[model samples]
Structures are given as C-alpha cells and as structure tokens.
Target: MKKSLRTRLYACLWCLGMFVFLMPEHTNAQGAAPSEHLVFSFPADAVLKMHKVKIVQSAYTEYFEMNSFTSGYAGLQQTPDSSKGSSHTLISSLWDPNTSAGIYSSVAYQASNTYTGRFGGEGDGYQSINPYNWVMNTWYNQVIRAWKSNGQLYVATFMNNLSTNQWFHTVTLAMPAPSNFLGSGNDAFLENWDSNVKWNGAFVRKAFFKDCWNLNTSGVWQKHTSRYFSANAGDSARNGIYDRAFDAGYDSTEDAYYMVHGGSTTPGAGFGTGRTLTLPAQTNQGTAPVITAGVISSVTASYASGITTVNWTNDNTTSPQLSAKVEILDAGGTVLYTQQDTLPQKRSTTFMATLSAGSYTARVTVRDIFNNLSAAVTGSFTVSGRGTDTTFYKFKNAYSNLYLGVKDSSTANSATISQYAGSNSYNLQWYASTQSNGSIVLINRRSGKALDLPGSAQTAGTHPIQYTVTNGTNQQWNLVVATGSTFLIQSNMSNHYVLDDSASSTLQGTGIILYAASGTSGSANQQWYQESVSSGLSSLSGAAVSAALMPAPPVTASVLQVFPNPAVNVVNITCKKMNAKMWIWFYDVPGRVVKRVAVTGSPMQVDISSLLPGTYFVKYGNETVTFVKE
Candidate 1:
C-alpha cells in the first residue's frame, strides 16, 4: 500500500536514530581494562620448564597468567560468577600452529572433572579448564614437560599445591606434525578481562612470580636472570584511558619479582612501559622439596639368622622420598654390601649375609623426588656365634691398682666411668658376652649398662661412659693380651683407641677415657687385670654390698722433695725413704715423658737446662712432686 512521504520519512528517521544510539561512543568502549605483562626470556636450548606464582591480591573477573609460551598460555582465573560454584579455575590453552594449513591441536588426555573444547575469541585453539579453589597468599608450582610422541609434539601440565604438598595433573595436549617442541619465549601477565569499566579498574590485582627455570637439552636447570615489564597501550586505538595505577619491579622481601595493577597503584621510579630488571644469580639449580637429613634410630644384628636390620625415619612432610642407599662396612673400613630401597615411606631394611664374626658399620642416606640427597648417618653392630658369659669379674688398672666402677653407683645412662678402691658392690663387677666377631660387650652387673663410647666420638681424650646395653659396636671391646695377666681393652669401632687411666692419676675418682693405644705391650695406664669374683663375694645382695663398701682412705704424703724449685741450670732431688737404686721419671703436663734418670743415692743432682721453661712433675717410687724450670 502507498503511504505518505512525510510518514515514511518520519519512520526512516526514527530507524536511523535508533541505529546511531546503539553504536559504541568510542573505539575501545567495549575493550577490557589495562593489562600488564611480565615477559621472561629463557635459554635458547631449553626443553622442559618450571615456574612459581603467588597471588598477593586478586579480584573477580581477573586472570593471573602464570606460564605463557609461544604456543599458548596457562594461568589461574577468578571467574565473574560466584553463585555458579566455579568461582576459581585453572586454564591451559594451545593455539593451532597452522590454521590455514589444516594443522590443529587436539586433546590427548583430559583429566576428570575438566572441560576440553574449542576457543576462538582471541585465537583459534583448544583449551582445558578445571575448577580450582585456589586461595590467596599461597604459592603454586607449575611444571610443563614437552616431548615428541608418535610424530606429534605433546605437552603435559602439572601443578603443585605448596600449602598442601599435593600434585595434580591437569591435562595433556598434542599438536600435529611441524610443531616439534615448545617455543623458547616464556611470559606471564596480570589481566583484567572485565568489560565493566566502573568495577574493572576499581579493584586491586597483584601477584609475585619467582624461581623461573628451564630444563635445557642437556638436562641442566637454568634459571632466568632477566625480565622485561610492559603494559598494553592506553591510546585511543587501544584502551581509551591511560592507567597510572600499575607497577612491576623486584621485591627484595619476597626474593621475587612482583606485578601490581588497578586500585590507585602508582608505578615506582624507573618503572615505565618497557623496563628490563636484572636479578641476582641463583646458586641452586632448583628448590629442594626436602632438606632434612635422614636419622637412624637403631641397628641390630642377629647371629642366628645372619641378618642385620637398620631402622630409620625421615622428615618427608613436604615431599615423598624416592629411595634410600644403604651400605655396610666391616671393621677394617671395607664396604661389604650395598642395597637400594625404592619403596616410599619404608622405614626399615634388612641385609642378609653369611658374615664371619666381626664388627660392622651400617650407613644410610635418603633421596627425594628432586634428586636431592641427605647427609649420611651411621650405626654399628657385631655378630657372634658363641654363648654369652655370665661370670662376673673386677677390672683393675695395672698401674694404679684401682677398680673400674660407675661413678656414685648411678644406674642412669651416660654415667661417668671412674676408678675407685676395691669393694664388694656389684657396680665394680662386669660380665663379658662373646660376639661372633670376637668382640666382647662388658655388662656392668649393678647398672646392667655396657661401657660405651658416646656418640662414636673420633677425637682423642674422650671419656668412656656407661649406657644401656644395645650391642652397638661402640659398646663392644676387643681384649688383646698384654704382658703377664694384663690385657688392653680396645674399642671395637677402632683398634687404635683403648681404655686408659687418665693422666695415670691414683686419685679415687680419676676418669677412665679412651686414648691411643701404645706399642703391643701397651703403656702401664692402658693395661688392665681382670680378677674373677669369689663365689662367697658374688652371693651378696645390693644392701649387703652397700654396707660392706668401705670409705676411701686419704691420699698418701709424698716422700720426695726438690730444691731450687725455680731452677735455671741444676736442681737437687732428695728422697727421704730412698734405700736402693730407683728410676726417676720427669713428665710434662700432657703425661708425656720428658726425661728419665737412675738415682743411686739421696740428694742427687741433675742438670735441667735442656728442659723447657715450664712446670714439670718428678716421680720417684709412688710419689710425685712439681718443680719449675726457668
């Protein structure tokens, strides 16, 4: 039907006005808020990669992009919809290498509760999304492994929740031929994808990225030491407004680089659109999941079963252990057996061997998933085929004629071992148990403790103490026959260390310590005489023995004297009780002999000019007197 020209013109004008009203007022009216990027440059030879990110601040409709390679990007996002229950998610996407050539990326393995589909808003690609309730102020580790599989390049994504010490595999994607590997350029960014201008730039978003590393073709981890910070252009062609609330720089407190945008953030000095920051060089290849050393609690050897079991524990609270290396060595420091334990959380291992009687040491070390090894710990044991001895006997120092007894008769572990006068108390009596390795464990009859070398100390002048019987090699001693009925008690851990009366002192409470063994005959202080207990004395009870013990006598007076106490060239020594020829010995403070002379008469003169200027002790008979040489 025909209509009036004015009516038609009015309708057309109304349609044109509506079209003009719907059009965008500016070119970037629908563009998102300012987006900041942290571009990282890696080594040219890198193949595998690892990175970390910690979101210090976040807002809805924000994406904290973590690892962005040449092919695609992976990051954490806070979705705009909170009522849908999937407020936070993890995303990984890869662009089609050659869309025009028909080459595309396809999903090889998709994890459960994850979505895989096509995305095309920014670029033609495939992406995987999984609901991840990531919290703020927590660190997350991401690792990407790339390899060629079946003539196609495959990349697998793994994420670690550092707070929970749990690892999750998101997905694996494969690209068609011609895409042989991941690109060398790695980057990250903080993005505001919200188009709502009023709220997009109103909230704050910040994150910290650090410990970036790439595994090169040679399998060595190389850390990225330089990075550049840049932001999207804010001109009319890009986003309509320049964002002054954006900053990116190194944070010394976190030992990482930080990026912040939105909510009145003022860029610090020298932080412009494109600025390169040089970071300190790292000494370690990568972070070690576990750092504590493995501890060995107890080690035992069974002669009947020919088995040695070692018990240990590890601080695997953060990372699971990969394996344990166990080594067993004989007394001669020769390695006898080695084993590897691969089972996680396995705390015990056994070594079976037809071992001859002798002392052996066991050493164990642990390794974590990151190939970090812990310090080694050691233990010792002995295997004996003979029966244990039950008879008790007293051990007397051949030089001092004093009996070895537990100090104060205390039954506690680490009780001091000292020499005391003879007594019927059981603390002075010990029974020797035979081991397959020809070593003996000396068990104190009263305390039921064995003489032990505490902590397996390898230093000289370490005092021997009594501890609960554990059959440890430190508690076992070898009885080497010396002159007459005296024997040298050598520690099973090392033959060079032997029991000795400290300083050859005759004091009632002089300590018994381990010292270097002298010659085959041994020094007088290193020699001991084992006296069998009489049947009558062995039948006494604790109360009876305590009552029969006598108080120690006062120290005897010296019968020797020295004149010219501070002598320069000569000194005179007189012995009031001297009757016949006797040997006089001069000893230094360390119990080492300095000079010796035969005194045929009293008031004998001796030259001292050769001696160093210090205090010296002269011994005659059983008496000792000090004199000064100037």
Candidate 2:
C-alpha cells in the first residue's frame, strides 16, 4: 500500500478496532491487566444482558507521541480467552496521541476467530452525541441494552448527558449479533497502550465504575458484584504498582461497586496515593411506577363536553414492566367507574367517563410487574351542561367527612368557624371568588361573609374567622390544589400559613385554624374535598330556593335571603334556621320600615311589585344586610 493509502487504511482499522478491540484469551484471568491499565470483571457464571455505567473523565494531561493509545470501554464478553467461540460486543472510547479528532466510540464484535466484525467512526457511529464532547470531571451515564430480536441478538447503547440533562438517542450497532450469543459476563477496561515510559506522578487521577446491573433471560434486572486486579502485579519488568501500577478494593467511602487504583507514571513507581475515587450508585432496586393525577402534573380537573377526562403520566423507567388502574368516584366516595390496563414503560394515559352533571374525583394507581404498587394519585372535575357554571361550593374534609361551616350562622365581625357534620344547610355552602390578584375568597353563602384571618395576623395558630366580605388580605386565601383532588386553603396574608384542622381532630366543632404549611404532611390537615352547589336561580313568578340546589350546609339561614333583587313583581324571602316569630323589617333609602314581614319557612313571598324601584336593606336584631330592588 502507498504511504498515504496505508495511513488511511490504518485509521479505518483503528476505528474498527474500537468495537472489536483485542480480546485476550486468559484461561482463568479475571480483571487482571497490565500495570498501566484497569479492568473490571463480573463474577464467574454471571450473564450480563444489560448494563448501566457512569464515568467522570480525568482532567486532560499531555501525552507523549510514543503513547499509541489511551482507551476505555464496556460491553459483554466471554471470559477465559477460549470462550471466544461465544458472542461478544464492545463499545470503546479510544484516543490516539497522534490524532487531531480527539476521542470517539466505535463498535466491534467477534463471534468466532474467522468471523469478526468491525465498523468504526466518530462517536456518532451509533449515537447522535459525539463522545468527544465529553467534558472532563463531569459525570456521564451510559446504558447498554441487549435483547433477542427476531432470532438474533442485538445491542443498543444510550447515554445521558448529566450537564445538559438530556439523553442521547440510542445508537444501534449495525452488525448482527450471533443468535446464541448470550453474554457469559461483562467487563470495563481502561488502558494506556504506551510502554517503557511513565510520567513522574499519577497521570490519570482515577476512573470510577459503579451501579452495575445485568438482565437475565427471565427479563429481570439483577445487580452484579465486580472484581478488579492490577496487570503484572509486583512485576518489576512491567513496572507494576511499586513497578508501574497497583489497586485496592472495598473502599467503602470511595465506591460501592468498584474503584480505580491510581498510579504514578515513573518507571517502577509506587501506587498513586491519597486519591479520592467514587461513583455514586444510581438507584439499585426497581422503582415502582409513578402515577400523576389530572391533566399532566396538576390536580385541577380538566373539563369537557358531556364527559370529564382525567389524565396522568406514568414514569416507570426503573421498572419498565408495569400496569395501571384508574378509578372515578362520586361525592359519596363510591367507585362509580374504573379502568384497568397495562401500558408501555412510560406513557400518558387518560380516563374518559360520563358523569351525571355532578362533581367527581379521579384516582390512578400503578404497579410494577414485580407487584409493587405506587401511591394512589387523584384529581377532581365537574360534569355540567354549562361549562361556565361557577357555582358555590361547600368543602368536606376527607378525613373527617365533615362540612366546613360558620359558627351560629352569625353575621358578626370575626365570627369563629369550625368543621361540622351537616347536610342541606346554607351556612356550610361557600362562594369561591377568584380575585384579580389571583387569590380566592371563601364567602359564606348565607351570611355572604369572607373566611378571614383576624387582623391579618402573620403568626401561626390563629383561628380562621368569618366576617362580612371586605376583600381584605386577611380574608383572601389561595386554593392550593394537591394530589387526591384535595385543596389546601393557604392564607394570602401569609403565603406559608394555611387553614388546618386543629390537631387534625375529627370531632365536630374542632376549630379550623391556621398553621405553617409544609410540602407534604400538614397538607392533609389543610386539605378539603370540594362539592359544588348551584347558586339560587331567578323566575318572574317568585324566586324560590331549590331543595336540590342547597345540599351541604347543616344550618339553614336564621336570617332572610331575597333573590332577583331589584324585583319587579313578587320577591321570595328564604328563612333557613330562622325563628318563625322573628320579624324582618325591610326599609327603603329614607329609612322607613316600608314592609314588616313575619319570618316563616323557606320561600316566603313578599310582593315587591307595589314598591318603587330602588335599593333596600333588611334588618333583624342589631344586625343588617342589604339587597338591590331594581
């Protein structure tokens, strides 16, 4: 071959050599290697079907021209050189002291002495990312997966760039692996092909290898134990550690699986000392599937026409073989509908179900093939004919199953409130108003009062009180929707403060107070499951409160409530939890008691058509509330 042609051919051959690097026939030799190199070997009889390895490169160092190559690699192989009759594949990072292109990974395989295969190129040969882009002292994770496909063995390699937080697409090797080539064992090696020369001190600080897992024919990932041996240990001619290299094992603080033994470059030099070496172990055990509730990363309900679709994303990277189950529940916590299915390792799944114009909760749970179940995640939604319906709601604590209500249904300033077991009462019903500032105010449907923090106190342990709506910061709360369709009422006065059940007490009248919110635990105490109720409707005949419309509060209002204010014809007066004898006096702007009506059961009618069109106020006892008559 011509000089130029020969150089080209040698370059091609070297590239191909990366994948099919020299496989020595060591009869019993495990990870033993030359002093200037490191090799890690798995236990005897261990079959490696998949491997996840990470490495942090050493800082750059000047290499003499005499040094032909410095390389690192990982792959499946048959130990005991005689095992070459079996199958083997390797992905190698090779560097030539004379090359300008820096470093690259190439694929090489050998099923038999005569039928070897090699394809060489830049790191892009099988991966989109260039191995040359690897930064020194930065961790990089690489995984090699092997499986039998269509009666042939195949291997694909992938890498995760820790710095960029992105995973490079898998580079599938083009060569076909032998059909019967089940990897007998796995190995990782680092080498300096130079000889008869050494730098004064440790040239490469250290290389780490940890988090080793092997897939078996059973399709289960099993952890592997690694063993390392220095080449030509104590050999003077080979410059073994004390000669040229040396290594130590079981450095508990330094590594969990394996650690590299650093060495000085000088001939007959001592082993490198005081070098810190460690590779943090990625999760070892299989990870259960992660179930997210709602429409991708949120707990709020996602609404649609005629039906509510609940969506969730599953993350089972650690355990790809898994299944999932989703459940939809009504206010009574009964599982009205359920869907059970299996999905590919990581996926987004949705559950679409028709609900009878009511509020419902959706929960999803996932389990790995190993039978480990994930925590159940939930979100909520309402199925209504009108999507724009922003009806009033009463919150019931899931733990206690009690409705949140104002004390005595009072209209007084700063009236204390607590959780109560109630049904079909107006005091427990609350109107939720989303303010311009992104906060929410929970107003009592009966008193029209805002849930407040007294004097806007910033300290913890303050009991939440209710007062007529003033739109004060003390009265404004933030609805923090958490998993399980539960919401935490966080105070606007203090972002960290939240409405919590006093000591998580389940007894009725237990004070609902404020406490510092946490990322997890206290959230349950502050959480509420919402049940929406339609606000009163209007009619020309006379506005009447529908029995079905008011269904959460335990106490009916003790005062009068008028609908379709500015009434042109008849007006309806609703007296819930009210004394039938208490007289309600309606006054016009001139302060004259124009009408004195006797309080009665709900739906009491007052013919306001005879009155002038204007605003009026209704009074009872020393308290007064207003309404418009337009």
Candidate 3:
C-alpha cells in the first residue's frame, strides 16, 4: 500500500472506510509473526455502523490527532480492535468558547500489534507515552458508517477507505451499564451491584449511524426503552463536593455543578456554559458519550490528606439499574479504592473518603438490587496540596425541591472548564478567574461592591456579600454565571435558623438566614434572606429577622412574602415571613423575564409583564425563591 493512500485512508475514514494494512507483528511462542487475522476479530465490533459525524463548527479542542488537522472534529465511528489486547488511548474533552479541558479513554487499535512510542502530526497528533512502539497509519475515506458499542449494543464501524477502495469493520466500546449501581456499607446513596443483574445498552439514537449492529451483536443493543430515547436525560458532570452537607441537600442538576464551568466557543451565542463540553445526549457525529466499567464491584484507595468525600446524583427514573459500586484505580489499573457501602435508592450523596496523595480514577459500576450491572461511569483526578475545601450548592428557592451549586473561590478560581447549564433551568454561576484589583469577581447584586468572605479575608464556604444596592437592609446576595438558565440569589437575611421553631429541618416559611457559624445551629435566629422577582432589579425577600419575632413575625411590613413572590403563573406568591416594599418584576432566569409593572425603585406594586406563566423567583430583603404557573 502507498503511504499517501494510508494517510487518505485515515482521513476519509471519518465517514465511510475500508482497510488493507500489513498484518500486525505480534510474536508467538514459535517466534513467528502474528497475522492481522490472528490479532484482530474480523467482521467484529470494529465495523462502522453509523455515518461520519462532521465538523458542524470548528471544534476548538483538537488535542489528539487521528483525523488529520481539520477544524471542528475528529473520528468516533471507527471500530476498536476486537482482539483482547488491541486498544487506543483516545484523549478528548471540550475545546469551545472556554479553554480546552482534556479527558482520556483507552481503545483497541486495529492497525498494528503492541503499538508503542507516539504519533504526532497536524492538530493534536495521537502519541504514545513510551515513544516508539505504536504507529497510527492514517487512511483515506470520506463517508464511513460510525458505530457505538456501549459494549453490549456491540456497535460496529464501517469505513469505505475511498482511497484504497476497501471496506473495514471495527467495534467501539461496550454499552453503558444501567442507571443503578451496587455498593457495600460504604456508599450512602447508590446501589449494590455485587448481587444484581447487569444492565447495558447502546443508547444510540443518533440517526446518522444506522442500526448496523443488528447484524453483529445478535441481541445486545436493545432500542433505548422509549421511542429510541423517550427517556429523559441524566446529568453526569459535576465538580466541587464537600463532607458535611447534611445541613443542606446536594444537587448536580442545580446551578452549582452545571453553571460553575468555564466559557466555550461552541458556535452561535451558546457557550457550552453549565454543561460538560462533550456532545449532547443525541447528536449526529464524532465520538458518542461513553461510560465503561468492568464487573469488579468494589475497590479501595486512600486520600492522603485534605478532604475525602464523594457526591452521587443522577435521575435514574428512565434508566433504572439497581445499585452502584465505586472503586479507586491506581496507575497500574489496580483497584486501590472502593466505596461499596450502603446505597440510597435515588438522589445524590456527598460524604467522606480516606485522603491520599496520587493520581486516581474513580470507576462507578452500578447495578440493580436484582444483580443487573450498568456500564461503568468513570472519572479521574489528581490530589496535591491541601487547604479549606468548602463547596456551595444552588437550590431551587421557589420549588424548594431542587438543589445545586457551582465551583467557587476555594478551587483556585482557576476557571477550570465546568459543564454547561440547561435551558431556563437554574444552574450555578461565577466566571472571574483573576484576582487583580479590577477583576471581574462575583459582586453583590444589591450593594454593587465586590463579594468576599465576611472577615475581610476568605474561607472555603464563605457566603459572598455586599450590603449596598437593594438587599442591603437584609444583607442580600445572588450567585451569577455568564451562561445557563436560572441563577440563585441570596435575596433575604434571616434573624433565626428556625431550628428553635421546631428543631426540625422542615417548617420552612420562617425565613432565610446568613451563613453565620453561630446562628446556623438549627436556630431560628440563624435565618437566611431570599426572594423572587418578576424582572430587572425588581425583587423582594421575606427572610431572616430577629428571633424575638418567631412563630410568625407580626403581620408587619417587615415580615411578609408572596413567593415565587413575583408571579409568573397566576401570580403565585405565598406570604409567610412578612414584607417590605414588594417591588415585583417577571424576568426570565436570563435576566430577561418581563415585569407586569415598573421595578426601577422599591416604591410599590410592579407589573409582571403579563408574560406567560413560567419559572420566576421572588426576593424579599434577603430571601429569593421560585414561583409557579396557573
């Protein structure tokens, strides 16, 4: 085969592809060379089952180069080596409006045997750590059938190496495990996969890739339960977790985890803000979403120092598996850490972990109590130095059912690439990475002053503040992100924590409070400030007041609230704490919601812009929450 033909084969392979590379040279006992036939599983999972996904826009994150240096893309539909040891280490992550963040996956390379060294050319050329054993022979193909395995689905890749006039079949990774997982006494809110059935599916709904696996996997890739994928999406990417959040619930779907990410240039105005930079759940091309895990249920490792904690959150209603097993993997792929303790049915959990110092990857293999195992959800990170590790989560102040937060100052404000937030759905915010004097750090929504910890210094869990603009009377504040749906605002101030009211986490109408150490001990005196607004700066809060006014602050103008105070649907604002000048406006979470009345000053009744009933939050002096529709 000619060298040019090989390069073309690699390039065109993104779409349809075919191959005729030399047989690999793996040595056998007799010292004879191993034929490609012996090294690869022909007509195996490697055939491209779908069409090549193209560069919609220039994908900025071009770190690895398998596909020649083009713009917006790389290859995904290509098949993996069916043979046991054949694999490729594919590194990918988001390269958009935000900076590039990298992630890696090991794949089976069908081209050669025991490939070593590294390969670098245009774009981010694929390379080997050792530097001379592996070689990625590029090929030529334009239209190829891209396939996704998810392992079980047995996705296949078929490329028509237009240059060589040959067709090749390759298999991708395995199907993702079911939504649930298994655990032992360690895990707080996951499944116990050890004794459950394993659930795996291709979840391949992208139309570009046809059902080529039908002829291969036999019966592994089942149509995603619903119409292809009628199932709602499950959020995966999240950052910033803590150990003692029992006082408050942790939600990755809320503003905290999703919006706290960096910016992206994904084309259009939509910077892949709050969500991970990977492709959407059901997009047409390139590498598809993947989660892999071996059957091994439990593994353990230790955290040298700092804080050791874990957070688990995923809506498994649609993809229900049973339990989940979390294992920590060492550099050699050995199970160094395992947390398969008692598991919770639903919701996310963040608890303690043994501290250690080293590079570690977490592998979560979920299963149903019945013994069904879901594919593995794997993530990796390294631990170095240590300091105060306080994380904040954003919660739905209006509905009160949702909880979420984003990475904050403690994380070095490195402006690391976080995931994008959902539409109109509240997510966390904050994008300032610099600390220079006029830096764009988070500022108080009311005071206009830059927000910082109380003592003129800063701590990990410090609540931002600035008592000037509006909530000044109640020390109100709000969290903001450059992109995403709704944002959370610390609109009210609490006089008590409500603990003295009933010593219970319930009985919420009392009032919102500050993050003061002394007050938060379940005391009503440690109340918070909150609110819901119709639009603009038009907001209100009916939160925290002096404990002396507990049980119910006299119906004084000082303690009344009509939340989702600022009405979106039929003006649904329930009054509890009491009130002040309830200047209301109806604005979209994007600071775009309209108001029924003017909201410039806090004089009186404002308009809701008569906009259709949607999600809106009401803000009292310090409390802010969501409102509903008719």
Candidate 4:
C-alpha cells in the first residue's frame, strides 16, 4: 500500500512539473528576436520633444515606439489580430508614481473615439489607445509636451500623419503631486510584444527614426546627434530565452537611425549591444516655428443671425498653424464671446452671440505647433438697433444720382441690379424689413425677390442680383451710417464690401457691383440715400414723379454738375449764370476737405491732379455733387 501511494504521488508530481515547464513555452512566449532600442542622449531636461518615425517593414504584434520619456511612452503598435486585416493602434501610457498611496497619473484629456483607462501587467499606470489603422512605409511625426499646471505635472501627446497632412491630439495625462515633469531617459524601440511562438522568427519589424528634437528647460531646441543601440536584457533574464536577431545603426542614405528586430535580422558590425553610434554633423538643426501676427481686416456683425463674422489673413503659410482663436469684446473691452478653430487655413471665422446694439471689437490670434503665439490683431464694428421704418423707398447712389433698379425690370431670379433714372416703376422700389437680429432685407416691390450678393462672392466686381427670398445671409444687408443722410449699403456676406456703381458711372442702365468699403463714411459710389416713396403711386404709366426724384435744373442752387466725373487730371464744374465768387470745397469720403477754391466763372476748371483715385464730394454754396478721380 505504501509503494502504491508513493507511485501515485510521484506520478502526480511529474505531471505538475511538466505543466510548470510547458507554461513558460506556451504562455510566456517571446518573439523570435530580442527587442532593439535607440537610446537618445539630450543636453538638458525638455519641456517638449518631437520625433519622426517611418516604418520601413512592419508585421503583426510589433510596436514601433517613438517618444519614450522618463515617465511614459508613446508609439504605434500592430496587434496580433489578423481577423480584421491590419489592426493598428496608437498607444500613450504613463506609469503611476505610487499605486499604494493612491498617487497616480490620470487622464487630463482624451480625444474622441479614443480609449483611456488604467493598465497593468508591466506596471500599474494610465494609458490611452486610439485605434489608428496606420499605413506601412509612411512617415509620422510625434510630439510629447510636459508642463506644470495647477500644482500638477501634465503631459500631452500629439501625432501628425504626413500622408494626409492631418494632426491628431492623442491624449493628455496629469500626474499627481510629487511627480516630475519630462525628465531624461528618452529612447525609441522596436518591440515584438506578442508572446505567440508562431510569430517568432516569422515576421520582421523595422523602422527609421529621425529629426529628434527636444525643447530644453531654457526654451532652446536641441537635436539628437548620437544614439546608443541596445536590447531589453530583462526579457532574456526573466524568460530564460535569448535571440540575437536584432540590428540598429545610423543609415547615412536615409539620414536617420534605423532599428530592426525579428525575422533573420542580423546585427551589423559596430552596432553590437551597448554600442554608441555617432551621426554625421547636421547643418539643418530645425528652428522653432514662428507665427507672424495675423491681420484682422474686417469684422461685421449681423443683426439678423446674431453672428459676428471676422475675416483675417495669415502671413505664415509655410508654418503649420495649429489653431486660431477669436474673441469678441464689448465696448468696455470685456470679452463677450470666444471661438477657436483648429483649421487655421481658413481665412474667416464667425462667432454667435446675443449682443445688444453697440460697438464691438473682434480680436484674432494664431498658434503654431510649438505653442508659439502670433500677435493679436483687432477690428471694430457696430451693431445697430432694428429699423422701425416700414416705408418703401428708392435707393439712389450718392455718386451716380441714379436709382437702384432691376435690369430690364425682369422678375427672374438672379436678375442683375442696375442704375436707372428715377420713375414710378416697382423695380426701382425696395421695402426694408427689419429682421429679428436687427439686419434688414430689401425686398423689391416688383418681383418680391430679395437683393442678394449672388452666392456670397467675395470678389469686388461681383454684381448684386435678385433672388427669391430665403432670408440667407447673402440676402441680408446692413445700412451703416455714412456722411449726412447717406448710408453705406454693406452686404451681410462679407460686411467688408458695400454696394457700388460700376466705375461710378452716371449713365442709366449701368450695372451695380460690390466693392470694399472705404471707411466709416465710404466712397460715394458705395453710399446711398434712401428716398421714401409715396404709397399712392401704383403704376408706372402716366404716374406723377415725386418731387424728390426730379433732377435739379442745370443752374439751380441744388445742382453742381461735374463733367467727366471720373476724370484723370481735371474736372469742369458747370454752374451757369453764377454771379458771386463762392468757395467750393472738395471733400473726401470721411468729410475731410481735400481741395478748396474760390471761383466766380460759370464753368470752373479745377485741377484734380493731386487727388488720389477715389470718390470726392464737391460742395458749392448749398449744392453738393460727388465725383470720382481716376
């Protein structure tokens, strides 16, 4: 009985021993080769570090680690799952400082569609994983930035896909108190993390690392000029397994350091473990990006939509801008609304705010990848209260003295607008209806179509047209107060441009277009005087002309006619039968007198050679006529 019990015990003990021996081979299987690393040396501690990686050869169950700092690591990995074809992912992880004391790294911000949680096995820590199907042989730029904020250390990771020219903010991790900012021990590695024995010696993993830069604590950038090649000795020591299929060295042809492991990769001479490789002297150590101050040219507030559109132009087109921030401030300089857009390539942006009628300013600033900020630029605009006048009126151009009318009085959509002699025609009349947001819509009496900017074209020569009323922004207008009773008919499309008679032509049937606004008091062609029409007139034929629409006699006190209004060098004023010498003042759009002369002749020739090419107003006695100097 004793011999039988001993035999059974020995048999059980042998099976248990076999199970223990096979566990390492089955569960703890290492890749076919040892993991290779390129340890970089930095001159000082860095607050920000950037690295580039190009996967030359990739396989399943391989991790091409990019930025590995002292506290965390970030990289791209290919999972062992072949069912989904190529399962790629981007991982950023930070080890906990002390798990027992409950001090650990936590997620500060996690991008959408990304996973962030606690991870274990190697060490307890926080990790973020984005399921990114990265393509092979493509270069990707990665960045890790650290800063101390709110008494805690924060680290953020970013990646740029060079193929698509798209940037992605992977994750931001915040470490609790007693945690250090980004320190030393920076390196990159090619790891085969899969323990599947079938993948051992079956797949190759290779990549190139270059353009490694670190922004040191002193706000200076330092480039990596040398690298030390090594492998993970811990894996071999713990698993009792070792494979020599690994190689890493500086590739002069690519100007980058190449690392490879697994699948028959033989270590080259002078690249043995713990060997340091010196790279060629680099002439182009990249400098920090500079973002020139953005220019905010126009800011228009739309009362109808409660939207304030800000337009700007960036001078830094070569540098990749990360974002543009816009702030709307009230008259007191208090910020009322703020908006940020990641697409800094766009020339314009809008902010929606329910603001009262008042003046406001729009401020814009741009930021680059290095967190460099551009100087702020600002523009001012006014939001007028809603118009209470419901009267239908004629829009007479201040420069041409011709009425705004539809071409040929056509009721078709997209019928171009033109200037014509005043008449009782419905096409020449528009009813301004105040919108909920204080903007006005000009509905023509003839076709019920709204005055439109036609697809909201930003070009200066784009003619205004009539379209069915959809109350779009192109159909909205803002009557900005100009000199005297005239108003600059500003388009809601850009708010920077106003209605203008083409070439400031006084001839009837000339087209009207949009041009950039001159200033608060715009050019004569861009300004208009609204004449209220009597409600009794219904038809055009045999209709009595309103006294206000009648043209002044050639010699009347209310008429100062100028020949060759858009003259090159001189203008002839025709005021026949003048007796007394009168002082004639030529004023620019802002009501500033540019030229003054005392003349008594019936026809006075005024030399306008010194005047710039723009609209000018000539006032003689009580009469004023606007002319354009070409």
RMSD of each: 30.5, 27.5, 27.0, 26.5
* Tens-digit per-residue lDDT, 328-424, candidate 1: 7889987766766443334565553345677878877776434457677787888776423345778788789889999989899999899999988
Candidate structures ordered by TM-score, highest first: 4, 1, 2, 3
Give per-residue lDDT, candidate 4, residue 572: 73
Q: What tens-digit string does per-residue lDDT give for candidate 3 at 1-630?
A: 112322322322222212322222212211110000000011322222222111111111111222211111223321233222422222111111111222112221222222211122211222211111111233322222122322211111223332344433232211222221110000000100010011101011011211111112331222111111011112111101110001111123321101111112111223222211221222221233122221332333324332333334443222222345666575668774454522223212122222235677767766532234666766666766542122212233322322122222223322211122222222232211111111123322212233333333222233333322221322223333111123333222332111111122343332222333332122222222122322212132223222432323323222222322223333323223334423333443333334433223322333354554333444443444443332
Error of 3 at 554 (Å): 51
> How many backbone clashes does every candidate have?
7, 18, 230, 1
lDDT of 4: 0.66
TM-score head-to-head 3 vs 4, winner = 4
Clash count, predicted structure 4: 1
How far residue 478's Cα lies from its native spot in candidate 1, in Å, is 67
- CA-RMSD of model 1: 30.5
Which wins on TM-score, candidate 1 or candidate 3? 1
lDDT of each: 0.65, 0.46, 0.26, 0.66
Worst window of 10 by summed lDDT in candidate 3: 184-193
Candidate 4 residue pairs in backbone clash: 303-437
* TM-score between model 3 and native: 0.19
- TM-scores for candidates 1 onward, in order: 0.42, 0.31, 0.19, 0.49
Which of candidates 1 and 3 reaches a greater lDDT?
1
lDDT of 2: 0.46
